[model samples]
Target: MSHSPVHPQLRLYFENPVGRLLEHPDGYLVVQYNAGKRKLEELKTFLTQASTLLQQRNWHKLLGDQRVMAAFTEAERVWITENWLTRSTTAHPYYGAVLLAHDVFARLAMNLVMNEARESGLVYRLFEDENAAVAWLLQVP
Candidate 1:
């Protein structure tokens, strides 16, 4: 894994199971997952780390870029919905962006997940471009 300090407070890490955590200026956290397929255990570990970051930072915004996640197992899907999505709803992150670039399957799944998240009182937006995602996140005061 290679990490580069994008900003004084923001660090970007890159790896085969690529993921980057951005400590946003407004106390929100952005996690961009570019990891390919992985086992349930791996997914759990990833989500656990993300959960910890969110809790520690008291993040009110989440940006998940699943552009490279080709597919997810049933368990992985369940974990996301039960843990990350559900928790984000209760946490009431100012805004959550799920970015999907190429994977149609993941995009579809995220759409459903976003809908469920909205029902839970969390605001979510789906986008295919990074610029748009960031713009939306920044606009939400």
Candidate 2:
């Protein structure tokens, strides 16, 4: 995924979307959408990756970089709170640091995720850069 993602038409290609789920050498997962908007399937795929990693490694920290990601639909947000959060991992993430895009729509989308997730007992903080995100992850809550 590119550090920044932008497009005029926002066309999506299903066979090879710009989304990526990668593990950082620092021992955390970093999920990114390098281009176009994220549909429900893409979002679920990423969440599945996180769940699988957590099941194996049991880490409760992850960096969700949505700088290149697009805004999410309301139903998508609800899906996360309902299904993903409930069945994600044995050691569900309590502290999440997110890197958001400069776009207001994307920022608001993330805000909704973080806020509504509180109802499910997940707390995530937004960050403009990776350094601050990792720093917050290291700090004890």
Candidate 3:
């Protein structure tokens, strides 16, 4: 996504080659992935940072804007599921509102990961718009 002006209510947390991680005033993490492929190391770093932030704040909601993100490689997917998601879910049954990627391959990759997340007890929903995703996240108690 373009690094357009950030919403006044959002706090820019971290911006890496992979994405921009923001903190919403209402208490959640907002990760807007850039429109490009990500190296495995970069992806791992970004997720580790996000998880750290989540644990520090005890936040349970995340808005993942993956509309322009490229597809994840098999290795990346495995690391995410085995390393990041498991750690995050064990800490809290977090709620995630994901805006699906425009690329069909990216969407498919995300779906596979999300399905695993569901089985792990995460409550999540997919959306095609940011407003709807944010609204759904806010409504989640």
Candidate 4:
């Protein structure tokens, strides 16, 4: 989908079949994914694009909204754990938010993954609301 300018310095768009990215006024990047059981190639392509953008812009904040990633095959979970979560450390955004809203099992799983991601030196939070997510991303030091 096309990216629309949401604010003077913010851009928002759907990155792929299952994810959206919001680049914010203060150099923050938010990437949201919801594709379940998607192929590893697809996830890599999508995340690679996002990583390129993040590197190009040097965004200070990154939000990953996986609220819709409700279920996953075993392979999918392993891919996410090994690829997405770990690879996030390479880009190194100052803040990261993993959004969750439904599916108790998925929420719990993501929470654990996020905790591990936090050890990589990025501030991370989990939220169930878009407003809260935005607030966390925009929070000033």
Q: What would the TM-scores of all predictions be?
A: 0.77, 0.78, 0.94, 0.72
lDDT of 1: 0.67
lDDT of 4: 0.66
> Which pairs clash (backbone N, Cα, C closer than 3 Å) in model 4?
none
Taking the tens digit of each residue's C-alpha lDDT, what string does model 3 give over 1-141?
A: 374357989888887899989999899999889988788998899999898888888899999988888998899999988988788656458899998988999999999998888877688799987889889999998
Runs of candidate 4 with Cα error greater than 4 angstroms are: 1-14, 90-93
Question: Arrange candidates by lDDT, highest first: which order?
Answer: 3, 2, 1, 4
Candidate 4 per-residue lDDT over residues 1-141, each given as its tens digit: 222224566576446665667676667677766645566677678777776777788765776666666555456556666776666675445577667746777777766666666775557787777778878777844
Q: Which 10 successive residues of model 2 have the least lDDT summed?
A: 6-15
Stretches of candidate 2 exceeding 4 Å from the true structure: 4-18, 88-93
- Better model by TM-score, 2 or 4? 2
Question: For model 3, what is the error of residue 91's alpha carbon versus the real structure, in angstroms, after optimal superposition?
Answer: 5.9
lDDT of 2 by residue, 1-141 (tens): 356442333222222364655655556656666657667886777677667775676667777777767777787878887887777434444667888877789788778777777766666788888789978887834
lDDT of candidates 1 onward, in order: 0.67, 0.68, 0.87, 0.66
Q: Quick one: ranking by TM-score, best first?
A: 3, 2, 1, 4
Off by over 4 Å in 1: 1-9, 12-18
